[model samples]
Target chain A: MITLYDFELSGNCYKPRLLMSILGLTYETVPVDFYPGREHKSEAFLKLNPFGELPVLVDDGLVLRDSQAILIYLASKYDKTGQWYPLSDPAVLAEIAIWHDFANRITATASAARLGLSMFYDVDIEAAQAGAHQLFRLLDEHLWFGEREGRDWLCAPSHPTTADIACFPYVALSEEAGVPRQDYPAIRRWLDRVKRIPGFTVMSGVFPAGPAIEA
Target chain B: MNRPNPYLNDHWHVVAGNEAVASGQPFRTVLFDVPIIIQRLADGLRVTAALAPEKPLPVLERYGFIWTSLGTPMPLFEIPEYDEADRRNMNAGSLGVAVSAPRAIENFLDMGHFPYVHTDILGAEPHTEVKEYDVEVSAERGEVLATRCRFFQPRAATSSAGGQEVEYVYRVPHPYCSVLYKSCPSDENRRDVIAIFCQPVGEERIVAHMLQSLIDDVSTITDMRRFQQTIFGQDKPILENQYPKKLPLDPRAETPIRADKSAIAYRRWLSQMGVNYGVIPLVPRVADV
Candidate 1:
């Protein structure tokens, strides 16, 4: 059995939960009061992850930190198809690495704006919003071209990799940060596709996408 | 002692989908520029203007939508096809448009922009020509009907395997409602029904609720909604930047062609009904100095 040190509202915590739900893995959630209590920064939680970031995942005895890294670990170990992580091909791994880093940028900007607005964290709202827009423009164009090329994910894979999972939360939650996605049509479409994935779940502000047209 | 309230007209507008507002949950939105609240009561969903929070408007749960009218309204229009046992009734999500309610309705009535605005999905560049179609205003029915319309689409729906010829029937049963019956992707003999119910939030803003009654067993509800959302998302940016945010009632305000007959008839019907709720009158040209 796997255990997740979780925060209900945090998008970072949601990434692992979302993937776990998708992979059909059973896990126990130890809810950490991330908002008013700030339990993640407490002494006990810091011992689990010295970086003091959520969410920490423990399976058997191996403890893991960072959302993207946890996603890598989970998919690599659990995914029977070997598709979600796709570590076999060096080229695909490299591509996934690029997007993994990009997800960090999304956390820095979009997540920062959300933290400032909802959680009362002090942040430069203007700069964060601008940075998010700049990143979203690129992602939209990338997905637009990807649609034309018959690719559905961030990397050049037929199936979704960790890259798509890594970057999805902040982009989907950008509106909470005062960033409107009205201009990003392709990104909006991609977000719907992501939400339509089976076993998909919703967070506090993230709503589920409606059904697609029949195949 | 008081002037007439023009916005409080007798028009049944869709406010939300049945799935959007659950029982014991309250949903708030603006309709006809009035802030309103919707709550699912034991009997049905109750809607009322925000000013008078206690009073409830007439509610009708039809076509997978929750509809309410501030004034006395005629019976809701009928779509006989929805009663079919084999069809899947789907409530596509609401889409917010920066343009006026009528402009969004007019856009839905139009086929000319499919080639450009929707691009390869609805229409391609080479198949830009919209063949002449018959359009008429039904005085007895108080509606506008456009028939015998056809177009070639690269991908008609999420179920579409490739390009095919799509037959279409457009109807404007209400000033804010535009319904379309088109070729079904799952079964060639059946017609898929899609309708857009425009909620006029302001003179230049609307929340469009879409419903699709389709004949498909394979596609998930999420896929169906996402497909429609994708098409609307493609149309949003163009709709927002249109000049004269509210649609002009006068025909000469915007040039029309043979393909715009449905749009023409719709405007004429709105004009005859004296529906100035969400329309902008044509501005008179001033003589140059």
Candidate 2:
């Protein structure tokens, strides 16, 4: 059985879990608590991943970290559905790469802003808010042009690929970081569509029961 | 300078405005067949499309489109009020039909499942409290109309320090489109709103129009624009994959766990909006309320 080292609430850790579930692969979830003494940095965990990020997937003795890399690996290794990862054309790979950059650069930044402001440490609120806005606007422009032209999936013609999986969590979770969903209805609608996918699972996060008051 | 088609295909058509779009005026495309009309409206940019009278439109087909304002691609659709018969036949293959209103509202109420479903990107935990709500709805011509509704949720860390809030808003224009606004506010009161307009094209798909702007003067718009571009680049893949041909919702398929609050609420909201709500089973465990 594959062993997934993860934190229950971490989005980065949840990626592999979501992928495994969607692909119907069985794995063991080893929970790591980040709040107490930095468990990820322990020597034993370091042997698995020097980076010490949660969500280290160990399958058949092959270890991998980084959510996107793990997702790519799992799909390439075990996915019976070729729609998840395609090695057919150069353009497809290029398209996947474009979204991979999106996940790493854009999504990471947004996630960081949320973490800085809400979870990790209280950083410069102004700077973090600015960063979040900047990211939202850029995404808005891209979607505007993309929708006008007809193509639905980011890279492929019809079906979703690994690229979509890479970007889904953070963008949807931006709202949790205090990024308003009302401002980006297109994105919200897109989120709704993603939720409709079969075998789709949500990331583990806290959501306010009532409407949140703006501070 | 030549700009590659954002949709990645050459055969799709693009709509710019009510007037025929010029061959090259920076318009968004949808489903490789229709073009969305983008224009500056009194509220913001209005995106719509004109369809030929003779065109064969589907019943409830939803399409994937992008809103430029946020640098994210979003799904857009046209859903008529549900008929009882239509509600019974809800399935993945028949998404074009309308569904229930109560179910849609229920979907909107659950917000706890963000982390598990999208994972790594959207959720970090399950079950957070909502701090405030702003809602506006009206009845039009004997039909229950949703003029606008905004919901806000605060993060835990900022909860004590007058935490930041995420806001969601929705608007509708009869036979034209629906506009949704999502915004974020920081502890320092810096705010940005991303506006998306969903316009119908044929029966299945709608074109998404977008605009994003920051309320803070601390940063230059150019800087904001660059930042928005990077963020949208990340969201492109998921949004692109979600539309045109979306996977059908199967309520009877699996029971969601306590972590799936958001997904559940979202489904209820869709039902309340008179759209079909899939019949996914609710997990037996109670969410951390």
Best by DockQ: 1
lDDT of 1 at A3: 97
**Model 2 per-residue lDDT tens digits across residues A102-199:** 77764456666655532333356456556767766766666556667764556645777777777777777664454655676556545555565567
* Native-referenced DockQ of model 1: 0.05
Task: List where candidate 1 sits over 4 angstroms from the true fold.
Answer: A1-215, B1-8, B283-289
| Model 1 DockQ class | incorrect
lDDT of 1 by residue, A1-215 (tens): 89999866678988999999999999997777554345688999899988888999999999999999999999999999899998788999999999999999999999998777544466998899999999999999999999999998899879888898899998987876778899999999999999998888766557677799997
State in Å the error of residue A17, model 1. Answer: 21
* Cα lDDT of model 1 by residue, B48-74, tens digit: 898998788988989988888878877
Error of 1 at B242 (Å): 1.6
Interface RMSD of 1: 11.8
- Measured by lDDT, the strongest candidate is 1
Lowest lDDT 10-residue stretch of candidate 2 chain B = B88-97
Residue-by-residue lDDT tens digits, candidate 2, B49-149? 43432332221122222232111232333333222122211110101111121222222233343333333232344434333343333433212233223
Model 2, C-alpha of B117: deviation from truth (Å)? 14
Candidate 2 RMSD to the real structure: 21.9
